[model samples]
Target: MTTLFFDLDGTVSNNFQGISRCLNFALEQLGLRQLTDLEVLPFVGPPFRESLPRAFPGIDTEAALKLYRERYATSGWLENSLYDGMAHAISTLHSQGFAIALCTSKPRVFAERIIEHFDLAPYFKGVHGPELDGKFDRKTELLAHLVEHYKVAPENALMIGDRDKDVEAALHVGAHSLGVLWGFGSRKELLEAGAKHIVDRPDELVHTIASIA
Candidate 1:
């Protein structure tokens, strides 16, 4: 069977509002200036440590992550909704016996909670993510771990996500990469990162995956 690895933020879940709010909350608490919604887009895919320092110079990554988590656990996590048609697409793929798994850079704890909250837990065979301490924060590391633990062959696997990192990670693991346009990353960025396929909508994703599988 073909294995499908999905990214949580931007791809399956539209948690932009919650993520932006929590990030600004962290910055505010740290006595730093807040970022606009557009300005916060780049923070969606990568680990907090990498994104935080770039957004706020001289900030303490650990403290910022702690504050973001504290606020996210309480309210920010709930401030999210599934992207349109994403549920249906996932259900259809699962019904068709695809080995679906979540491969996100977000902390595993948060990824699990978010998936459960959106009732998406049943659709996935596995939910893999980084540790709370930020170990395996890179997409390549996370993807490598998932592929090994599940014994999935790279040629039989596909990675679907919204960021360049996702595309690069798939390339690193010798898997196919599909970039989604409805997410944070731009089409140009996805192309630059060497995405093999690009889909504009959830229905398109279903079609693309069907064609490949």
Candidate 2:
């Protein structure tokens, strides 16, 4: 059976609106000017501090990190909702014998909530997410830990995500990568990062994976 690790935010959830709202809210509270959607959208995949600096240039990294977490935990994170057709795709993959799991940058506590909220618990064998600290900050490190934890060989595993981070993560661990265009990222970005394949929609995902194998 093929093992698949999926990123949570853009890939499984259509919660970008909530994320944007919360980010701006945090900025507002910090007395900083609010960011436009396009500006905030880039924050969706990268670390909060990295995004915040771009949004609030020359801002203190420590304070920015603190406020980012505070806002997300208090409001932004909970506003998330799973994307349409995700449940069906997950169910179909499970029934078809794929080993699916979540490999995300979001913290584990909220990751668990998102999974349970969507009633997607059964579809995933495990959930691995990067810590808020720098320890597991990169996708490469997170993917490596998940691979070791699950005891799945790199060749038998695939990482599915919406951004270059996901593709980069898979490649770092010698796993295949599947990038999705339906999410926040563009095909140009994924292709540039050397994604093995790309899926335009949820239903097409299964076929894409099979063809890759």
Candidate 3:
């Protein structure tokens, strides 16, 4: 079976509004200026540890993350919704005997909760993500751990996501990557990051997967 690794935010779920609200809330708590939706769009897929520091220099990342989590867990996370046709795509892939799993930069606890909340837990074999301590914050590390722990061969594996990090992570492990255009990242970003294939929507995802898998 073809082993598929999917990114959570932007790829499977549209959680931008919730994520932005929580991030802006955290910034507010830190006495920093709140960002508009456009300003927060780039932060969707990357780890907060890196994005927070870069967006707000000299800020206390740990404290800001803590505040963000506090808001996210209560209401922000629930504000998310599955992308149109994503559920159908996941089910189709699973029924076709693909070994599907989630590999996201979001914290493991939060990822699990989001999947469960959306009733998507049945579609995946495993859900892998970083810890709250930020150990697996990088997509490279997260993908490496998923491949190693699950014994997925790099050549047979495919990473599907919406950002450059996903493409970079797959390349780091000698795996192929498929970038989705419906997400936050642009075509230029995915191409520059060396994505093996790019699809425009969830309906196109299955066709792209079949071509490679």
Candidate 4:
């Protein structure tokens, strides 16, 4: 069976509400200009360490991260909703015997909490993510760590996510990638990132993963 690695934020849950809230809170704390939710949309897929610096030039990345984490750890994490049909899709995948796991840029502690909150823990065999200290912050490094720890061959894994980084990370690790359209990324971005497959809906995930497998 192919090991299916799923991204957490945009792929499974629409975390924009929480992410934007935390982001704006940090910006406000730092006296930076606050951006609208739309302006904050593009930064949802990547890690804050990378996205924050891009979103606000000359901002103290560490300070902003600290502020963001404070709110996120409190109530911001609950400001999320699973994408419609995501729970069903993941459940179906699990029943079909796919070795499913979560591979996300979010910290493991937060990711696990969110997964449990959504009742998704039963479907995932593992929840892989970076630590609070910035280790495995890069997709490539995260995927590599998952591959090593799980002893899954990279070629037999399929990465499914809503961003270019997900596809690029799979490519770097010699795994196939599937991009979902219901998330934050565009078809062009996924294609440009070398995604092997693209599915427009959560309902399409099962068939798409089967095809890739």
- Model 4, 1-213: lDDT tens digits are 469999998899988888989989999999998898789988877888888877678889999989999999999999999999999999999999889999999999999999999999999998989899999999999998888888999989989999999999999999889999998999999999998799999999988788878
TM-score of each model, in listed order: 0.97, 0.92, 0.98, 0.97
Can you rank all candidates by lDDT, best first? Answer: 3, 1, 4, 2
**Per-prediction backbone clash count:** 0, 0, 0, 0
**Which portions of model 3 miss their true places by more than 4 Å?**
none
Once fitted onto the true fold, the runs of candidate 4 whose alpha carbons sit more than 4 angstroms away are none
Cα RMSDs of all predictions? 1.0, 1.7, 0.8, 1.0
Lowest lDDT 10-mer window, candidate 1?
Answer: 48-57
Per-candidate Cα lDDT values, in order, are 0.91, 0.82, 0.92, 0.91
- TM-score, model 4 to reference: 0.97
* Model 2 residue 91 CA deviation in Å: 1.1
Supply candidate 1's per-residue lDDT for 83.
91
lDDT, model 1: 0.91
Winner by lDDT: 3
Please give the TM-score that candidate 3 achieves against the real structure: 0.98
Better of 1 and 4 by lDDT: 1
Colliding residue pairs in candidate 3: none
The candidate maximizing TM-score is 3
Instruction: For residues 79-192, write the lDDT of model 2, one tens digit per residue.
Output: 887777778888888888999999887776668777987889988998777666655767898899988988999999999999999999898899999999888899999999
